[model samples]
Target: MTAASRPVALITGATRGIGRAIASELARTHHVIIGGRSRAAVDAVVAELGDASAFVADLAELSSIADRAAMLPELDVLVHSAGLIGPHEPIAEVNVDDLLQVFTVNVAAVHELTRITLPGLRARSGSVITINSGSGFTSHPNSSVYSASKFALRAWSDALRDEERAHGVRVTSIHPGRVATDMQQELRAMEGGEYREDDYLTPAAVAQAVRLAVETPRGGNIDELQIRPQ
Candidate 1:
C-alpha cells in the first residue's frame, strides 16, 4: 500500500511471448505473478522472474480463471495477456467450436476474472489492463472470429472503465497489431507460407506500452491505447 512495499502485478499467459515480456517489465517495479495454462511455461517464467510466483489458469475455462483471481494476493494491477489466434476461417464457413473457443478465452474469461478481483481492486484503487488487438477495430475477412472476440473484449473493457470509475478501479485496453510471438508464428503457419517476423511489433515494445499505462499517476486513466507495427 505504501512506496516501501512493492505493488503486486498479476499477469496471465506469462510463460513466453507478450505475457513473458510483460512480467519482466513489471518485475522491475512491482512484485509479479506469472500465470498461464501451461504449468511448465509458468514455472519457467517464475524462475526467470524471481520474487514472482506461478499459477495455472486456462482462460478458456472461465471458472478456473475466476478461481485463480479470487485467490490472488492483494494486487495493484491485473494484466489480461492470454489470448487465442486460430487459423483463418471464414465466418459462415468457420468451425463452430473454434469461434466459441476464442470468445471463451478472449471475452468471457476476462469478465469473470474482473468480477473475481473486483473487491481487491476497489479497495486499492487498482487497475485492470487487457491485451487487445487492432483487428478489434478494423475487420479482416478471414479474421472475423478472432476480431469479433477482441471487439467484444474492447467493448467490455470500455463498459468496465465507466462502471469502476466510482470505485477507483481503472480499466485500460491496449490494442496492438500483430506482435512477433509464437501466436503470430501459429497464425503465419495457416497461410502455408513463410512470413516476415520483422514486419511485426516486438513483445518488449508491447510490454512497454503496458508499463507506461500502469505507471502513470492514477489521476489520469488511459481508457484505451493502441500500438501498431510500423
Candidate 2:
C-alpha cells in the first residue's frame, strides 16, 4: 500500500522499552510516529523505520505535549505508553512532588492528548490504546501514587471507549505485570526492591499484545487486555 493507504500509528515514550518495540511492530504494517523527550533517540528510531517519525514530547509537561501534538498529522492509532513512578511511601505519607509528577504524566497527559486526538481518530474510526498496570486493578504497598494515577487512567479509558463507540474510535487499556525494562528497574530501585528478572515480562511480549489490539479485524475490538508473567 502507498503511504496514504497505510494506517498511521502514534506512540508516546517510544524512545525505548515497550514503546520502542510497539513502534517497530507497527512500522512493519503502518506508518508509525513516536513521541519522546529525547531528540537523538527519536531521530535514531526514525532512521531505522523509513515510514516512521518522531516528535519531541514530555508527558510531564503539558506544553510539550501540546507543541508535539500540534506538529503531528492525524493518526489511526494513539498508544499511551508514557508513565511515571512516584516516591515509595504509604498512601498517607507520600511525597507531594512524586504525586504531582505521576499524576501529571499518567492521568493528565492521557486526558489531554486524547482530548486533542479524539476528533482526528473519530474521523477515521481509529484506535486509542493506553498502557496500564496490574497495580491499577488491585492494591499494592508503597505505590499508592503510581496506582492512583493508573486507576484514573483505567477509568478514563473505559469512559472513552463508551463515548467513542458510536464514532468508531475503539479505546483499549492494557494491564501488564512487571516488565523487564528500564521503567521496571527504575521503579524497583525507587521502591528499594530487587525483583528477579526471570519473574518479569519482556517489552517485546507486551508489544505483541499491543499489536494484536491494534490489528484486530474490523467491527470488533479488544476492549481490555491484562498480561501477567507466569
Clashing pairs in 1: none
lDDT of 1 at 2: 20
Q: Write the per-residue lDDT of candidate 2 for residues 143-211, one digit (tens) a residue.
A: 788888888999999999999999999988999998999888888787779967888998889999998
Q: Which digits, one per residue and each the tens of the lDDT, describe model 1 over residues 85-164?
A: 86497777888888889888888888888788788888888989999989879878788888898889989998999999
**What are the runs in model 1 whose C-alpha is more than 4 Å off?**
1-4
Candidate 1 global CA lDDT score: 0.86
Instruction: Say what the RMSD of model 2 is.
Output: 2.1
